[model samples]
Target: MKLRTWGFYFAEAWRGVVGNGLMSFASASTVALSLVALAAIVILGANLEHMTRMLEAQVQVVGYLKPDFDRRWSDLLVQKVRAIPHVTDVRFVTKEEALDRLRSELGPDSVLLQAAEDTSNPLPDTIEVWVDKPSQIPGVVRAMRESVTSLDSVDYQQEVVSRLAALTRAVRLAGAGFIALLLLAALFIIANTIRLTVFARRREIGIMKLVGATNGFIRWPFLLEGMLLGFVGSALAAAAAWAGYRWLAAQVALGLPFMPILRPDRVLLPLSEALVAFGVALGGAGSLLSLRRFLRV
Candidate 1:
């Protein structure tokens, strides 16, 4: 198309928005509200998954050796533990090292450390095993028991890890479904918005058809009008979401430093881009779908 024709289309689209001021405002507001909800869920689901991964990393199995277990066999026991299915890595801690860790955990000024320095360390040699996933902990622990007779005890946070894994799955499933519903509602709302525009301009459309204008020519302006609404609403939503998330992140950092919320920079940029894209696409699709019935003129 020539620059002149493009200019004409844009002018017509702008007129469509400006002529029906109330409907345009309603359309943009609806789109903005829908996208705001979508953005919140996306940010929340991403942080929840991040926290799940952090918790997964901390899950480990510790196997303590019998008091009489020979120190020479430590290397052999480590190799056997590493060979177990689902075991990703293994580290052996000597009795002395364990005692030193306990001492440090007790702090430099603690009376417990003073007493421990003069006495024999009662801590045992232990093997720490890491797995790729939380669910594999039980199998790995069972394997450790059957394959290594020197194990005086085997332990891991089985209940907590299990619950966390289940919760992550539920959140992902629920978040995805809710996001889809919100987008669908946004799509239909855009369609309704365009329907109102088409209804208002029905006489103009019939006249254009009578004058031998092609359907494509008639379609371009409405399409642009829909996209314009989408762009305006999405821009507002992005700005609002960005500002809100930034404030929330700062507040969380100051008040609950231990929470694993993602930084705004890590999440907001991509989230804003995605919201804009989804909003525009939905508007274009909704417009295209609604114009079909009106185009019969």
Candidate 2:
């Protein structure tokens, strides 16, 4: 389309809003509330995903070597385990290294450290495998036990791993459901808003139909109006959600010093862009459906 044609469409859409100020406000408010709920869900899903990842990162499977195993066998085991698809890192912790770690954990003032140093260090050399996915650990452990001969036993936190897996699955399901409901709500709000606006201008539409105006020409302004309403509402919603996310981040930082809350900044721009696309798509869809059903001329 030409620039002037585009400009005219925009002006007509703007005029529609100006002509029905109250209806416009109502439509914009509806869009804003629906988008705000969607934004909250996105933020919540993001945090849950991050927390799950942190927990997964901390989980590892340790394969302890037999007491008389040669150092070369331990190296061989580390290399074989590292070949696993989701394995991120594999480290061999020697008996002396384990004892040193235990000593550091028990401070110099600890009598336990002295007693530990005096006795024969019972800690065995082990290969610790860090995996990218919690689900991969069980398979990797099984494969290592079958393939590697020097390893005595594999140990992992079964309860923690199981719970993490369950939590991840539930969060994903809930997130999908929330997003689907929010989109449906947005569609209903926009369609009803357009219907009311069209109803208020029924006489004008009747006269236009009686005259030479085609359906497309009559439809352009209302469609553009819906688009504009959605865009503005989504912008406001994004701002509100961003403010809330920042405030929540501050509280998290103060409350739990150990947990690292990801800065929402990383996802803000992408999320904003997604919202704009969503608004445009929803607005266009709602306008088309409403006009087709109600504006029969």
Candidate 3:
């Protein structure tokens, strides 16, 4: 289309919005609210996924050696553990190092060390095994239990690992279902809003048809109007979501420093772009669908 024709379409769109001020506001508000909810879910799902991955990376299996197990065999044991399928790394922790770790954990209280100085260290040697992936941890642990006869105990945070895996799956499934619902709701609302606008202009539309104007020409203004509404609403939603996420991230940093929170730049930037694209697509689709019935006239 020519620049003048595009300009005319935009002007007509603006007039339509202004003419149906209340409906336009309602449509924009609906878009804003839907996009806001969608953005929140996206951010939350992303953060949860990040947290899950962090937890998985930290997962390890600690195999405690029997009390009488010879320290010289530590290297051999490490090699054997590393040979296990899916085991990515293995480190042997001596009894003495375990005692020192205990001391450090106990803080400045040297009394425990001083009392045990005369006695043989009761702390057992440990082999720390890291797997290629978190899901492999359980299998690796089972293999260790079966192959390492000298193991006094095999341990890992089984409960935490299982819960994290379950949580990740739940978040993904729930997020998908929720986003689908929101998209459908937004489509329906926008389509209904545009339908009302078309209904109100029925007489003008008939006159335009009588004057030999094509349906495409009549359709462009409403399409542009819907897209404009979606763009404005999504912009507002993105701004609000970004501010809210930053505030929440700061709060999490202060209150729960150990917890992993996704940075805004890494997550929000992509999310904002996605929201804008979604809004525009949904707006255009809704307008096109609503105009079908009117165009048949």
Candidate 4:
């Protein structure tokens, strides 16, 4: 299209928006609200996923050796555990080191160590196993149990691992469902708003058709109008989401310094861009759908 024609289309689109001010505002507000909700879910899901991964990375399988096990086999056992396919590293903690760790954990004045000092250390030698991935931990634990005959017990917190996996999956599924519902609601609202605009302009569209205006010509203005509405709403929503997320992140940092929260820069930029794109696409789609029946004339 020529520049003049494009300008005319945009001008008509602006007039449409101005003509139905209340409807346009409603449409835009709906889009904005939907996007805000979507952004919240995305941010929450990302943080939950991060926490899950952090927990997974910290998972370790510890195997305790038989109480009377000879010290001569410790080095060999460590080397063998390290050789396992998914095992990243294995370290043997001697009874002395274990006792020291207990004392440190118990604090400087704890008499628990003093009472045990005269007696042989009751703590068994332990093999600390680290895996390349959390998923490999179970297999590594099983392999260690089967291959190491001297192992008296193994501890990997199986229940915790299973619960974390289940929680992550549930969060992801719930997020997906909620996002889909919000998008659908936005689409319906925008489409209905554009339909109203089309209905109001039915006579003008018919007149244009009689005057040899192509369907494309009749469609462009409404499409642009819908896109403008979506753009405005999305911009507002993105701004709100960014500001809210930043404030929340600051509060979380202040309240829970040890918890790992996603930084705004890492999340907000991409989220803003996505919201903008979604808004434009949604607006265009709504306009296109609403214009079809009118264009059929």
Top TM-score model: 3
Higher-lDDT candidate among 2 and 3?
3
Candidate 3: 10-residue stretch with minimal lDDT: 51-60
TM-scores, each model vs. reference: 0.80, 0.73, 0.84, 0.79
Task: Quantify all predictions' global Cα lDDT against the true fold.
Answer: 0.85, 0.79, 0.84, 0.86
By the lDDT metric, which is better: model 1 or model 4?
A: 4
lDDT of 3 by residue, 157-215 (tens): 65686787788778778878977887787787778878887888888888989999889
RMSD of each: 3.9, 4.9, 3.8, 4.4
lDDT of 4 by residue, 1-297 (tens): 799999999998998898889989999998999899888888887887787677666638889999888999989998888888988878899989999998886766778887877688888899988888776778998899889999999998656756867876887788789878877877787788888878888888889999999989889999998899999889999999999999999999888876778899999999999999999999999898888776786
Candidate 2: Cα lDDT at 239: 86
Give candidate 2 regions above 4 Å deviation. Answer: 2-4, 54-59, 63-89, 94-126, 131-133, 139-162, 257-261
* Residue-level lDDT tens digits of model 1 in 178-277: 7788777777777887888888888888898999999999999889888888888888899989999999999998888778888899899988988888
Instruction: Give me the runs in candidate 3 sitting further than 4 Å from their true place.
Output: 66-70, 94-125, 133-135
Candidate 4 backbone collisions, by pair:
none
Q: How many residue pairs clash in each candidate?
A: 0, 0, 0, 0
Write one digit per residue (lDDT tens) for candidate 2, span 228-293: 888888888888888888888888887776665678797677788888777877887777878997
Stronger candidate by TM-score (1 vs 3): 3
